[model samples]
Target: MRGDGSTPPRIPGPPVRGDGVEAIVAAGGLHNYQLELHAEYGPVVRFPLPGADLAVSVADPVLLEATAAINKRPEALFEFLTPLQESGNLQTLPAEEHIPWRRVMLSVLAGRPSHEAHFARFAELTSRTADRWADRAGDEPVELQKDLSELSLRMICEYALAGGLEPEEPGRVVAAFEDVLTEYLARLYQTDAPGTEDERRARAEEALTFLRATVDRVLAAYAERDDGPPERSDLVAALVAAGESPARIRDTVLMTLLAAHHTTGVAISWTLYLLARHPDAAERAAAEVDAVLGDRAAPDYGDLKRLTYLDMVLKEAMRLYPPGPYGAREATEDLTLGEYTVPAGTTIFYPFWAVHMNPEHWPDPEVFDPERFTPEASAGRHRLAYIPFGIGPRSCEGATLAMVEAELVLAMLLKRFRFRPAADRTITPIERFVLWAAEDIPMHLTPR
Candidate 1:
């Protein structure tokens, strides 16, 4: 808003012939659209989203402080995800409800006991995947995103289910999970018509049923285990212990699997892609991993903290290509940011990638420099300048788990192999609920 309590400058975007609707659609995706908008209109740009609603995109880290503690997400933007939840939408759950729900999630996801309990199994799955890649023909091309996505799905499934799933079950579960997301995303993106949508929803319904049944089987097995739920907690056991309803528990598990499948995998893929392109950085990461886990195939949970350079490389990759490109919050009350004010109910877009690229915060923002995250260089940076996981109370709860999973997998793979971009390939970053390669990230892997 202006000084006299008027609206802020109408952002300089494509003319409002259709409220900038056509232009937004033409700009490809919100990822590219926000990039173009911020470059032209400066840090704050108001642009049209899915429903022709004007949203303010804030790229400046200092300006973002006005919204750092907002706990509310925009209802309209998050409604698309409600269909996945029968009880309610996790993304748009009311603050009263979200607070407790987030607490439950954090306890399970961020718990050190949970990480310790699952670390061996997670490492085994990662080594198995890496060994398979090592066995492939030297010249055979690998789609890093596709392969890592499957591995991540299996890893998260085991972590969430806590050994309830049979060894053969993950492949089928991964297929069903992918099916459900594919159908829903088609509708969420408006890429399908009424008839096509109906069929897709039907398929999604079937896939959801399959997923719920699988979870039920796991829960039953978990209940019947002779060891009595093991010493460590998983998501299902924690939710069950909390006395959450069956539907609610199922929804939470489904949501976790849905959330984990792409994010952890994509983060690893991007990190590997970046490392492969920067051999000096890759060598440094490899050296650190080798030093930390000499003669071992994978790292012990305690070794994670010792692999410092690998952490920096992974953090730098996310800085360049965050798993999710943007996150939004709705103002519950009037707010002032810089010279402008935002009215209650206004949707404030946090374009994370743009925030990361702000010239004011990052000198040579386009360069992939891992040293940017070294403790000395990082100490002076604004806290929100590098929000790959997002901000506020609604930020990702699995951040600790994600970092552990990513660093361990990078250690396991980089210790045993060298990766290079496949010839004639380039990565185009696009938003699809998360930032993803417009095409699969193709690469060549050679055993060390």
Candidate 2:
């Protein structure tokens, strides 16, 4: 009962939105819609979604911080992951219930042995991918994002399935996921007639079911076979250690796959774009990789930590294009953020991706600047201001794993070749599924 508006028009049916509303919100996709909203409402816009629902878009960091601190699950949708989480049986499903569980998961990840295993596999994947890129060191333009998307998916599957699946299977899974996601995006922006939205939702749901079943079938066999803990680290080991049920474990693994597949690919794509645009930075990264890795040798676990500029470039790229582009949560009860108070059942959509690029948080936000992340220069900056992995306790669990993999792969490729944007490059983004360039990104690669 806090804000002012003229009885907001009712939009109907599962948020079956139109191009006009989309345009009002920047119809190109969520990212653009958000930017448009921010520009129009100054970070506090009340949007009426379909089905008589209301979502208040917010970007005020202080409000975000307060809500994130006092809020618990049920209020935060993240607590209810989809499908499996809908059943709500986890110990930490609620904020109070989640403390102990979060500690356990955190302990598992924080464990030295776990980190060692992760780094070991990271090294193996680095070498394998380097070998692939090296073979095509000539005129091929490596779609850094596409390649990593597949690699991250493959690596995650290996970590979960113990490396038994054929190489081509993951591609099929990714395609199915892409189809489902694209349909969902269309549903979000389209003003479909009554039953049409239901049909689209059904398709999206089926796509998810398909993926979930595939993971279950694999995990079922993985469960019976007694493979002692993998010597090299991976998420699969975490699954075994957690002693999760087959269905819950499958959901978690697929969730992990989706997380690993999208975020890492987005970052990798941006990194390549920045590197290609700024040849000086690319050359410096190449030099660093060459000097650190040496001729005919791949980077080791130790070398990953030493790639300073490469790390900065990755950070900068993420700053520009965050993987978790936006976030949404419903207010379970009345609450006040900044100057506004929202009522119970109000939805809030906050995009850290847009905040990262806010002119206030970033200087020349659009420009690629690796120096912004240098330890000394970055010492005084707002760490929260540049959260590609997001912030609070909800930050990505696989963050460290993803970053190490991205930097190592990017550095290895740069060590061997230079990639440039293709002729007449059309980097149109399709918000259908993941925010990816609509036309397949074409880049030309040349040997260093």
lDDT of each: 0.83, 0.65
- Residue-level lDDT of model 1, residues 1-448, one tens digit each, is 3556776644454444544545655777777788888999889877767642777889999999989999999887887677678888888889998998889889989999989889999999998998788778386778888888878888888888765677676677767766676776655456543456678778778887888888888777767767665344568767777778887887888888777878999999999999999999999999999999999999999999999889999999999999988999999998777766677888899999889889999999999999999999999999999999999899998888999899889999999999989879878886677888978898888888
lDDT of 2 by residue, 311-377 (tens): 9999887777676776565566766766666777676666766677677667787888999898886
- List TM-scores for all candidates, in order: 0.93, 0.82
lDDT of 1 at 179: 66
Model 1: what TM-score?
Answer: 0.93
Clashes (backbone N, CA, C under 3 Å), per candidate, total: 1, 3
TM-score of 2: 0.82
- Model 2: per-residue Cα lDDT at residue 399: 77
